[model samples]
Target chain A: MLLLSRHLDQAPNYRADVQHFLFGREFRAEDLPFSEKLIRAHVKNGFISLRPGIMPLNENIFDLLGIRKKWLCARCGNRDQEAFAFCSCARCGKKCVYCRHCLNMGIVRSCTQLVTWQGPEPGFDRAFLDGRPLCKWDGVLSNEQQAAATAMKRTLAARESFLMWAVTGSGKTEIMYPAIEGQLRQGHHVALATPRTDVVRELLPRLRAAFPDVPISGLYGGSEEENLRAPLVISTAHQLIRYAGRFDCVFIDEVDAFPFHFDPMLEYAVHKAAKPGTPFAYLSATPPSELKNRFLSGSLKGVKLARRYHGHPLPIPRFRWIGSWQKLVQRGKLPSVLHEWLKNKMEAQQQVFVFVPSVSTAAALTELLQRNGFSRSAGVHSEDPLRHQKVADFRSGKLRLLVTTTILERGVTIANVQVGVVGADDPIFDEAALVQISGRVGRSAAYPNGDVVFFHNGKTLSMVRAVRHMVQMNQEGDR
Target chain B: MERCLFCGEMRGDPLSFHNLFSPEYAPGFCLSCREQLVPIDPRHCCRLCGRDLSRLDRNRVTEGTCSDCVKWANSGRNGLYVNNHALYHYNPFLKEMINQFKFRGDVRLADGFAAELTRAYRRIVHNCVREQSGILKRKPSFLLVPVPLSSERLLERGFNQADVLARQIGAPIVQALVRVRDEAKQSKKNRAERMRLRATPFQLNEKAAVSLSGHKILLIDDIYTTGATMRLAAEALAPARPDSIRSLTLIHG
Candidate 1:
């Protein structure tokens, strides 16, 4: 193998091996396992290209005036001067600046070199393109879903970005099946990227089951699978930082979710992960105003599905005044109104989702509920180490109630589950979050109706806007 | 426009006359991040290890000395080594900060503690001057000797955290020791195992040992947990016949 790598001009398979790893991914020189000689041979052969990992910030008129110096991270496109720091580098033996924003991925210093392949694309396994359907899922989509799916397929084939403005529980994942199958049959690489790890975990099994014959790899923070050559990849947006121009078609699920909506780095990752002019499909219940304005102006092709797959109206949140719930919980007492509502749900043998404004409130309320004979309840926050186990136990009906923060407001579905938002007046539950929290109920067709109550000390505009938003969606669904 | 090195928030230091007239102010941390670092008060700390005696149980602290220091003193391992002066108490926040600096390769975080390390080093020098009154007419300078790591470990971690921290003290650093054995991390060992005197993992560099013949050596490390590592390091420097040995650590667990 060493001899073959050394004589790269004579060894055809050796060049293919380099291309296989570097095809669409941008990797640091140290991250690649190959020796420098072989990589240099590839570079000499015009099969590989290298660029500095960090570059000077684009020169403006002020920069020409010699005002200040700035740098940009080529990997994550971070131009924030605050996110860069200089240190005495051990590798370069000089003062090196690195981007701290994407430091968790890998340290990209000014002296580091990023390598990418400029060679011909490797051929994918086209055995599945023998006129047989790729999707094996037997479930049928609703008429609205079918229409939106068709529009997505058409727009994506035309190489145009499309947005699926669908409500929660609108079978958004199922709508992408046809488009994904179309992409896969043509031997094109497709990816489903989401903001949160929970959403990726939730979508992985469903996507795998739908396309059993295709090789699927799921990427997350600590995921064990590292196979990047798979044609269909499901990963969190953070994992896409290492990829460049990889996917021919990318579907961003939950485009307006936390960290993704507020962080521009994830957006840059998605853009870098896809080939230029590659079509993007954005699926969201509540897109940020930028995308909404673009869609409303008809500049972007899209479809809106107001109705859910179950054809049931979304459970509009009903506001109930509960005086100072935080003080009550702190005083080791559940609010009377919320207590009565939970008791009624418990007596009816229904599981409950008690959403709190913060982790401390969730912990206190979980303990208070357990003390009040709700012994099977548990609290889960983003920092909880046993969060996965607790969520699994709740899903399996081993736990009667789950008290959670906004971490579980989306991408979680439990049948016949009723929601009670403690301190809904808190600023943490914005209009988008409240809609997502209420959308958690009435998800399954078996139990198409569940109660959603906002137990608040005082009604805020967000609460009113959330209710109004759901009511308008319901009106549109009726039409 | 300066941002906190830890939390990335604006430092927001008011433009007072002192700050305006002072030499270029180094960006350190935000007020909230800085408040999390619980500094060990010199008056209320164990005299030997500089640990906060107020936080320890009364039974464990007797006459301004912690029980661990008492045990060390009785063990007769203090050849020419003195005590350790730690800057802060080992809280979870500092533990995380150290983890980032020492393990995650965020070497820039060392700049955040430059002022504190310099202040602690100055206090040590001042105390040394007061102890040896007229024999040392001027402030005696100590050579900074950061605890060395094995070559394998240094390659793995990219940089020695102690060396980075020692550089911030603005003192002449002497590489007088090299780690001969790649032992397991001191953090993974229990207190009893660490306290048990065993073969030292350090060896004196013959080239640098000649310069350390009579100078005061101050060993720098991220944390002084059991003081066993410090004692073992000092024992390694015994062959050099240094006049005295002391340590300055960022935390006392």
Candidate 2:
């Protein structure tokens, strides 16, 4: 497992302690038996953590936990009959391996249960989705998105899991509407889970408008809807801590964001919240090639919606290198070119957000900007007490210019704002941050175009690649 | 032979030295015979000062945790534990008698700890219990409550480790000290990371803390760590501005 760690093929911050099941008992790789097929299977699954080896408990799980078997399959009379077959796994190539029948769960097995919470709610209805309906977009769906929706609708009709590989502005949200609407129509509960609170807030009104008569609640940390009695619920992924499979349609928006991208529990939460025959649709701009490869192998159903909602042009980013900011700052000065850009914008009454590599640098730059007679600028970092207030001020124009770290990059948007990234060449700034930060610009159609400047002294590959990717996604939409 | 102090069994878990097993000169033990291990009453011990309550070499029984703890009579967790209101001597009485109560499934030992604590708190608890008691001794500044077992542990044990002891002292106990980051169970962590781990993991209850503004605090915990837990707890409760935070632990080791 450390061999994988050595590759450092993933992000540098990705620390998978392969040593976790490492000591304690002499269990080691090459010691246990996983057929090449099993290893290949999990490798293809992408998120597996040498998982099968961690049996957690091996005895008759009921016998191990000493839990009573409270559930009996109400179907065919065989007491030991297996649960539903993958029948046809829309993921993993399945000939029809049914889940162990007696597991036709939702039955409380308190006696043999080792874990406190039994995952996967047994009888969740579509009514849960009624609480927070799918968002409403007051525009026509692009033909690509319409086609994608029709396909998703058909897959749900057949009970298959699908992956949606739509570009950032490709109206993936609208395509999700049909699936959510179908589940609501079936009277099954629906849950739309995303990785960001900003997106959840953005969708609250949209979903409320789309499913006007249904009960809906936005679920996130500090959210008001813990007593989720609705048919639809919109929640950030982490909020699912209180939930498990209790919904018929689980829409995982932005399936590739932090924590959610790496956390195994989230996958567990999604599976637990989804009912039998429920469909999971991963909505994302970049379909981490691992998932895309799975689709190509015919294991997962892939649908591409290469169209934006308003068909609005994606704001393409152009890069400028303003290298080694620490050296420049050490001289008690701002790089003149970047200084000129900021001065020009402020003079024009335009609002601007500057992204820095780290919190310390963000503070330093905020001080610099404020000292330069841009006194209205304020720093936004996790350590700051009034972060949400600062964001609100930026939005209301109470703050003419705001200096922030990457915290506002992905999830926050201030309307009609131009973007600048100080020291974008710093290794900390990467493809995802750049794309999401650039995305901060050109939010609305009338104000759809905005400039993204990577104020770096030397350009990094991630910068060039991020800009190229944005252009590619936008160009792909044109066709 | 030393009689089993707990369960009054014939066998016990301690080795008997000439005076060690004797019930008289030893300040009471015969741990095996009593069916209850009473923590050996510490002697020559300074009560106001929680040091060598026993004249015995303290070093022989427990190793000093760090240079700081080794040199000082107590880690002196800030001024919070200036008096170090520690109760048990960590003797056969604590090991056997308390475990019998704590794990053999009777919560009565906690109450007994409380009773003994009341004996310790004769001056403080009495005022709190008296008529119009609250208005009586300035209401103990504000309360710097103890860190609790995570929710998982709470469900398993049915109660908090610090709550029972805190409630016994008649001190206003608050459950506001929260474990924000569910740290991996640190039972086995070493000193340094354990110290760093404490910082990122703890937080104060917002409402209880704000209310504590300008008040004195009684920080309570069931057991003391390398003093890392207490130090971190104090930081988490910052901006609440407790006039002075004092710590109380049932056991020091």
Candidate 3:
């Protein structure tokens, strides 16, 4: 048998009868590199031997790098990968073989994870749209939804790009019907995306009625719309992560919301999901500071609908003092003044929304309201599995006076809702949240105006600012 | 002088490190080699059942993939090439030769494995080497991976069984991933759940992760049973940007 000490460019035929064999050791201060010792072991095995007169069989450092036992390329005997290209193996379907260019593209073959896509989905209906929704058109166009519809129709017909920075209840959904129809007529795809599920459930029925002919896919977790091979995709931002450059046009509804704003991965996912040079239009009422800076810097496009189509002035919520909500709830009591106000609203056949600071507050107040003759009130929080159903119950008028935390503060709509905050001074009820909570009232066109009463122990700057902000948004709308 | 043990296959060349480690010289042999020389070859036994090829049912599922994988080839939708590298079938002399080297610590038995592997060739090895060379004739990127040992087992054994062969093969070995899960030894678990849990745990850290991206991974192990370990590791690596993957084993357990 032959033994080859791994001295590259050494004279060949270096064979000797073995007296003793010794492997490299950690015992001494300087052990040879791990790769060199492995090459020596290979030299130790007859698996390879020095061909006489040749400088061993190969001369590549990576081959002798001791990383893999068979470091030699099965194709060529090149030492470094930069010298080769890569392509898929024709014989073997899953394997990638290197030619020359492959070495440079970082061709690492990973074990493939095989997932079976269940195939294309079926249910989609888009027929005659009801009154082609035109929202936030001209301030006096009370019936000018047709104009809003016209503008949207023109945008989709030409694939014209635009943003919709309309405030809450400015009828963002109503404005989309014509755009969706345009996509159906033009044979293109359009997607409306919002991060909130409450909004999805609220919009599904409306979309079903509007686009009764074209197929529409409502995408979110637990949705089996795998085969959304349709013209419309309404999806949450997180679901966009799996796709790579698929959608033609992406409309980001509530693009300024939490995970989309806070997570870079979600942003990367969205970027990857869209086609090259495709238009991404965002609809946000209250955008983040970054968005405002970008918009001001002329880095992004901006559009706005400043007035509520209902034309009624945005309600000003007045703040009054109440000591401690926990104390108020202990005796199954309702604040005398607040109770009288709710009683008057109920007598007038209007709905009241009692917005509490926490789920605990909602539960305590729901019981207290029931005990004090407001027996129709029910507490709603995310912890309830039937939360969606309960909200539906409220919308259907099966329940009245819904007491809730921030869960129903956005994404849900109810007509003639008079919103009241139990502890408006608490910082948990920040300016943005306060505005959304207040916006809950007077959403639908049926009742254009509703009262907003905010009760607190002390007047907070947030409360003052939220009311000012609501009035300013309304004024901006009226502009 | 240890009778200049196991060096018979070297064209009777004078002893050297090559001959010392070569199965030809310090050829690893079973204790029975003193009586009869056993043979070794590329494994023909089912990687799943480890059943002898003569006993293959042709209808058996072979657990995870051995059956379906072969059938799915070229269909385009979902398929993989080749069944597995672990189909150890050799003559009596080769088996005796390998068992002695492995069990008796006749570390030089690598030559016997190499020789028997070369023998089972029937011209296939040279043709494969030629064809592979035609494509990857350049600096061949081999992600030579030592079969991972559970941290506990690796610490206890002080060496990986797979590394022993990789050393003899003269290839680069990546110790990039570790099996965090202490999967019950393969002999015990047969279900896919065990495979999923075990497969995902073989995760890559930063360096292994970097090197793994777009690499040609050669999953080196000592045995293949149910191919659970190999398949799991391959699946885990599939997302890491490896260009392709194949496994090489010293013997089928």
- Share of native interface contacts recovered by each model: 0.21, 0.00, 0.00
* lDDT tens digits, residue span B8-116, model 1: 7788887889778878678688889999999999889989898999999999988889998998999999888898999999999998888767766787788889999
lDDT by residue for model 1 (A1-479), tens: 88878897565433778898998999988789899999998888788999999998856877656666788999998988878877777666778888888776667888889999888898777666678788999999988899999999989988999999998899999999999998887688998999999999999999889988888989998898577568999999999988898899999999999999678899999999999999999999998788889999999899988999989999888889999878887889878898899889999999999999998888889999999988889999999999999999999999999999999999998889999999999999999999999999999999999899999888999999999999999999999
In terms of lDDT, model 1 sits at 0.89
* CA displacement after TM-score superposition, residue B95 of candidate 2 (Å): 26
TM-score of chain B of 1: 0.96
Q: Using lDDT, rank the candidates from best to worst.
A: 1, 2, 3
Q: Which should have the higher TM-score, number 1 or number 2?
A: 1
State the C-alpha lDDT per candidate.
Answer: 0.89, 0.60, 0.57
Question: If both were scored by TM-score, which would come out higher, candidate 2 or candidate 3?
Answer: 2
For model 2, residues A1-479, the per-residue Cα lDDT tens digits are 99888787653221123211111112222333434454344344442233221122223567456553322212111232212212222122232222222221221111211121121222333444554534444667767778899888778757778899876655577788888877777776778888777678778877787767678878876677353447788888766543433577788887777657665555655665556667787787766667879887989886865545657766877667666667777666787787899889888888998888888887888887777778888998867889889888888899988888777776565667899888888887878778778877877656777888888777789988888888787777777
Q: Where is model 3 chain A poorest over a 10-residue stretch in terms of lDDT?
A: A19-28
Give the winner by DockQ.
Answer: 1
Which regions of candidate 2 deviate over 4 angstroms?
A: A1-138, A296-298, A330-332, B1-253
| Per-residue lDDT of candidate 3, residues A1-479 (tens digit) | 13455454354332221100111000111122224454344455432222211012235676576553322232122333322222232222433323221122122221111111111222233342344542222333445444655665565455555566667777777676656655555445566777777666667667766656556678776677543445677777666544444556777777766556655546655665666776666666666667667767766655556666676656677777776756767766788767888899899988888888888888888888888888777989868887877788888998889888877777777888888888888787877788778777777788877888898888899898888888887786666
TM-score of each: 0.89, 0.53, 0.48
Clashing pairs for predicted structure model 1, backbone only: none
Q: Score the docking of each candidate (DockQ).
A: 0.40, 0.02, 0.01
Where does candidate 1 stray beyond 4 Å?
A1-18, A35-41, B1-4, B9-26, B30-80, B89-92, B134-137, B148-158, B174-214, B225-242
